[model samples]
Target: MTYRDFPMPAGLRRTVPGGSETGGPEAGGTVAEPAPAKASATVMLLRPGTGTDGLELFVLKRAATMAFAANMLAFPGGGVDPRDADPDVPWAGPDPQEWARRMDTSVEQARELVIAAAREVFEECGVLLAGPDAGSIVADLTDPVWDEERDALLSREQSFAELLIRRNLVLRTDLLSLRAHWITPELQPKRFNTRFFVARLPEGQIADDRSSEATEVLWAAPEQLLAANDAGEHRMLPPTRVMIEQLARAASLDDALRPAERVWPVLPAPVEHDDALWMRAPIDEDGNGLPPTVAARNGDRPQGELPVMTPWTGGPLNERVTCTLCPNPSPMTLEGTNTWILSAPGADEAVVIDPGPLDEEHLQQVLTDVAARGARVGLVLFTHEHWDHAQSLERFGELTGAPLRGNFPGAEPVTDGELFEIGGLRLRTVLTPGHTMASVCFLLEEDGILFTGDTILGRGTTVVAHPDGQLSAYLDTLEKIADLTTGSVTTLAPGHGPVLPDAAATVRQYADHRQERLAQVREATVGQQDRPRSELADLVVAEVYAEVPRNVWPAARQSVLAQLDYLDAGS
Candidate 1:
């Protein structure tokens, strides 16, 4: 219940070693039961200001020394004091019973949350929302007398109910609208069941950056703040970031005040991958990252930009198969690698393909899922040797003791067109190298889905990862995949990205993209035909990849080198 003023929990570091406050499960030891969440509240104070929507929000940069979410940009909020439930407190606007219905909490807890929201906003920003009566709001709170009262409240010298009693003021519950509820993930040392509120800036009163908890303060448009976050100026917690994103869609203050259809508490859990930890949380399917179930995006999505492939915990693709997405996300790994679990209807055994990155939590998740289905891992298969999809085989094999096969080290060698049967389902492996000499695809013959491992992807073209990836061999692999997809393979479940409906069409797109790149490379070598390989690769990247981000230019160069080799060999 009480954590010392440290950014990360001490016990967590002791057990998780390199882990931070991202709250990943302990790698080497048992984690203590998570502490209960303290009921808390925060408010997004809004007003008319610069930007397209003519709306701006008040924000504070928490002091770096804070125990939780240190140095993050946040709204004004604090925990509910036990005294906030005082029976004699002034009342106004919607009563606690109505709020209980709105906030999905007990009438008593709703009252406490509302009181905490008003009290913290006033205590932290010096702009009180209550007045002597329900009909009016307090104005001009910049005087020293008000400052003394704020200081008293901050130091707990006076409770919020006492301050309201002294001023003969009633809490303006109507001014605040319930926006969202977010519970801190259980992996945290300090957790909060936080109720979020949105309110307009009271007229004739100015908010000041006088809160002792904040080192800096600002008022910016929602879009501007998002741009800043994208540019890495200020870091925001997921809750705050999501709220601002919603606010950016507003055309006016009335649109901002519009009630939400529904609010669900989002709790983000940590998932480890790519030798690091990333937070995994659920998002609406239509809003942002269309979670890979999108059967056909080719006709819908824009030409150049890929749809937001938001990080997700993948779900069941059909009756016999499920994809558990790893929590790793990056430009290189779009929404992390996919780990497929295949079984028969009501079978007690399953086949797990690509256990994915050496994340202790992910491994446990896979095992838990297998057990949940009343099944044990009958076999483990790695599509390739790339560390992202293949490294955890040894640890996983130890845990499951299942047969290990496919392109990983110390696994049974897989030849082209080998059949791996499990749970009465036949999975035929088609050796489609190129991404690596060992890359392969698994055909779930019954379901008509081909799990393409890095040879093709859901979002964009697969990177032919240089010397290890030969362009000529990769082209052959694509052709082979295209031919096999016609008869029974209707869907493509790519190893790294989305699962699409038309497998054959996607393969053709990959082929077309490859040829386009080849043409670009040939054109780039117009006058520099005799240049060194490295120089030629760099030149091709500049000529062909000018529109792409510089961060990915290194990867583009590798692909260019492969194209150069393919071209040189042909000549």
Candidate 2:
């Protein structure tokens, strides 16, 4: 296994993961492996001949011994070679100037990068994107005479374009389009200004991966790949993960190809704090729109007067914010991932709470917004260390230079009664265990808001995750939160979904709902013939939460396990 270590250009300091302006948040330890910088390309190859053939991406699994992407699934391309810049080759479409302007590189350099990308694609994948000479009995590129030229070019004995010109083959710039760019975050020594590209696999040629960089290769549909990744069945870098997620939404190859031609630049934004680190891409174009304004978490108007939310289906992106820039009724996955921007009321130096996912773009938008406010981020407060929420902490903190504060250890976990001061706001931590042992919620005195990670949510019921998520402890924690609401809690801010108007009512509903589910599960299991755990879960899910998706039954089984443990303890 060959391991390549590519270093970044000198004098450029590595800041946050996603090209964020550094020096706000304290540095967190490196999160994930430091990705080696390489000018690699991910070709989203399409076969336009038959619509039924669908979209197929050429993919490779790096050899386990390779230094950069060892043992990982990847696209077919590698670092740029100097020979790719030769000026003698017959050209296809767009001139180098257009690419240079778009890529923000010198015309000479941009030409070389594109050449390298094309050359590497052909050499490793065996898909010759270059055009065949007119009226030739055989494709000039496949001729045995050209093998020496190809080998010499690969070995840096000759220029790629010179090899092409010597054999009268045309370089197919027309076949490729710029997709996005990614830079490895600064925390690690290895970095690359990787430029991803897209192209169609030409006619009469099948991909033959020649490099030993990858141990295996396959061409799979985007949806299949994303499913495998989501199910923890495949490994993908953050960029690959996001692109696959985006591509899965498209219906056909044409739909996917149209977007790639638009030249969207993927900005690397890694947010970091004292305790965590991760990367995300920027969400939108910088300086193209007005900066978002931070809204007070607690509104002055009454809950009934607040605009009634018609359940949004376009996911969290389309959700509307009430008199604030942050989305209200933030859409969430089953686990209830609630995200909030904690700005000082009428002040700029606010804190961001629970920047969800290691999404590079969203983190970049966050830093851009923070910078626009004329005040940098002061802190990133985590509600818990669950994979869904806290994974991006290190990146967010590193980008903003803010100290991270949470209820768990490392860096600084807020004590059961510790108070955190950010700008003019004060957040009091309540050590509410259960719903996964270390769960904690924060009471924002400035906004009268409670930021609950997963101990509570605004919609649906939270299951005691079992073993790790204890039922008894969770129930006890709920009772305690209910106690707070009964006294002064007016609004409910949960980790998942939207904020609620009535805190006390919501807490009571949560408690009652869990009890109801447990009771139903208990009834279904009692005096029945012994059954497998999967069978018991299926029966209990249908009986208790018929509204929940059947696909989530596996998750429900964990909850059912806890409920059974509680019932058995009493028996």
Candidate 3:
């Protein structure tokens, strides 16, 4: 998308009332550099609105006495505390390492960001974003006793972690999904590198207007807030404005709380362009001219690419590993099929995995690369029978003069724990069948890298191709993978997208996501068990997957049907 950047003139009035001044570089006067942005976290607490309305977001008006964004409409948040980063904090939900990877920060920083978000929400609105355990949120915090705790927290008498521990509570970090990251413009005197998180307002918990920092607090539908901003009746910082605009698009609370496909850290800067001052941030190549803020919300921006050893066409990934990207790119395949070449250091023979679709050029490219490495193909392996990964299997076999092997028919079937030594490199097969009945993953024992073929994708969840692909079996398979290789596997070389550095965390997330989706599907289908199964699947998709793109719903429908089948069979 296109984003304009220009210098902020010294006297230009700020569009957002109560926002910091946009003055910088006074005409012909010495210019002062802006201060560094402090790390901060903000939470948008949301709940379902009355009747057919959408989500209502909790917003606060900062007290006019505040030094920054005084009288501005905003969410509950503030800078992180050193104690927030304490490693000993009893946490519940996704681990900090997973959050760290998702937020593009360190593990300690991730923990601190989550703690800051939850703590600030409680301090500003008297709503605790914590639970008594990993799976349950604390239902009520309106008692007078909680007021004392809140006061203690605000007064820094005890850290948030200490308060939770004393009360036997667990911070439900899982409830908070990162929505966006924004850095205040360079010209603003007070800048914050803020991460905005969205969370459902905990049930039975009332958000009181007890904060000394806020002049007012109210719950308003996102559309209403956006309308107020458009009419100049309400003032918000640029990041807040953008977040509200994005939230306004959601049709319901479920839609609003859908996990973001990607999070882009936007650093808006003022620059001189076209004889005028304007603000700009980097536009993603696929942004299609939408503003960077909007593009980020729409998931158009590529989050971050994996560290590639060679060009997109393929080359050496490391001293002993190489990969070639197949020339097929689509909505599902991401970049293309990844055909990896694995060999032991200084070895004369290598194993070729997932030769990919039967494209003559791609096959030739693979052969050329292998020959160039001076390593003859010793073993040709297939992760599955999927055309993207195995269509060229026979051709590859003929070209390399190596036997084809996999879990599929007409090849040497792979057994669980089956080991093979190819030129000093050790390989073992792990049966991971649910993406397809024949799907499998190969682990390089030496380096602890698992080559997962569609069982786990590089970016999004893999489709559980129904009929043949059962949801129950898939969940079991994911658990099996997690158990078999949690500590041993260091990286994941998937058939698509980028290589995952933390295999255990990624697998755990995948399992959690599936379980969450199953729960959602069950909740949506309750009391409709007597309906026709086919019609029920469509209904589940309509009710539970409203925010999913229409094009992908067909595939999602298959998954819903599988979940329904699993539920029905159990009942």
Candidate 4:
């Protein structure tokens, strides 16, 4: 059946916002949606490339059975846990009160959410954002006391304040930067007021993904992976999908990082179209320091209000999300990420690329966009298997009754060179393995929009992770993309960051960067005694990337090991 006929889940009736729980038939049947809630704080983690080439991000595929965005790709983060607000969590960077004000939340709630972000990141991704002084109450991360203390906080057994005083640990509040904010939409049953914060991974610790809510995890370069997802190859969540699109627009992780330093104002999804939903550079109440397009659309119109929608205001028609990093989408506020709606010319139906994270409000927003176009989603496309890119695969498919499409080898694996048409646009899949064994790239034949999932990017090189990712395979993929330059493959629409005009040159730069890193790695290991892969990496990274943060050393070591393996295999 087409999406219009897709049956809603049992008990999935719309509700009026002001209705009583057990009153009128309308209350039990359907009710007006409540305004979305506003949340404070977003936490993002970054890892240096495991390969010698560039940086990557930690991502995970949420289990399909999850209540939130079932079977979607996502970064490691969630709402703030109560302990996050504890003053005892230890503050290192910015004050929690200031953070709350910047995020537009109460100081107490802000503290908790930040704490929760830190706690959740460690629990889900195996990366530690907390510092060493955890407390005399808790010996060390490995110590049983530490586990007990952590569990007590996680389980709500002990207050964060108690734990803080019991242990001398302090929260490194300075480490976090205000990245973005997203309010849940008014149409959905489950909602969250989420804050996005960006932080670099700690040095020496490896991201040990817990196989619970997240079935798998890995570090990936945005451009390369997004390229795959956009081609309907990889799956991703909305936030992850949009974040990568923004990352692709950056020239380097450093360039992308500049924005992280400034405190970003949190913007909520307009409850009613009449409610204001526009975002721009943070404004001071004195009516000064406003960026152009800051006040693009002000005034609560109504639910599903349409004002020449673009990625900056969610995304375009046919689920065509605009890259937040792109220059075209105006009055940009970090409402998470912008999604695109893809429609092939001459076709009545369209394909939804990067349905985005499994946010309840966002899902509704996409549906509104879809309804506005009077088009049904024919298929769902993923850039790659990264959580941020493909997290919403199942939900989008379920909601739209559209079949999932992609070439990556997984539960619903597609083959290389697969092509599908919708609304005059054509998405051709190209198997671009390296970021992961199943990575793929989609070339939009119509507009020269080549969606390279982690294969190529407008900025920064893609990482070649070991184990799941291989340097040899990634390099080969880069070469294959560069070869596209000889033909019509010109503009690159990556899964993460932004789109690129000179696709061929970008691919060439990626390849050269890898080669240069390889040379440095070889030189670093020339005189050192043989050591474990991780140990050897410590030596090599110090020589190759003295400029990168030290917290990413483990990932670097992984890259060096992958290279060593490639050399040993002589492939």
Q: Which candidate number maximizes TM-score? A: 3
The sequence of per-residue lDDT tens digits that candidate 1 reaches over residues 295-332 is: 12323432212222233458899889998888876655
Candidate 4, position 172, lDDT: 64
Model 3 Cα lDDT, one tens digit per residue, 94-151: 8999999888899999999999999999988988878878888888776789999988
* Candidate 4 lDDT score relative to the true structure: 0.55
List TM-scores for all candidates, in order. 0.47, 0.42, 0.52, 0.43
Report the Cα lDDT for residue 341, model 4.
66
Worst 10-residue lDDT window for candidate 4 reads 20-29
**Evaluation by TM-score, superior candidate among 1 and 3:** 3
Residue 430 shift from truth in candidate 2, angstroms: 47
Q: Taking the tens digit of each residue's C-alpha lDDT, what string does model 2 give over 198-293?
A: 777776667765666787787877777878876867777766665665656667766766524344344333333353333433333220111112
Model 2 weakest 10-residue run by lDDT = 19-28
Model 1: how far residue 158 lies from native, Å: 80
Off by over 4 Å in 2: 1-42, 48-53, 133-150, 259-264, 272-276, 284-571
Model 4 agreement with the true structure over 1-571: per-residue lDDT tens digits:
0001112222212221211111101110122223234233445677666565356877777775454454566777765543455565566667877876776668887777777776666556555565545331211355446556656654556665566556655666565665665544333323456767677776666666544677777677877778777676567644455567666566666655544443333232322223423322122332122232342232423223422123223333224433322122211111233345666434467666666666656767677665566677777777666555566667777788887866453336677888776666677888888867777777777667677655553223455656778888888888888887789698776554445566765565456456656665665676564687667766666655443345445555566667777766765
RMSD in order of candidates: 20.9, 21.9, 19.8, 20.5
| Of 1 and 2, the candidate ranking higher by TM-score | 1
Count of residue pairs whose backbone atoms collide, per candidate: 0, 36, 6, 107
What overall lDDT, based on C-alpha atoms, would model 2 receive against the true structure? 0.58
Model 4 earns a TM-score of: 0.43
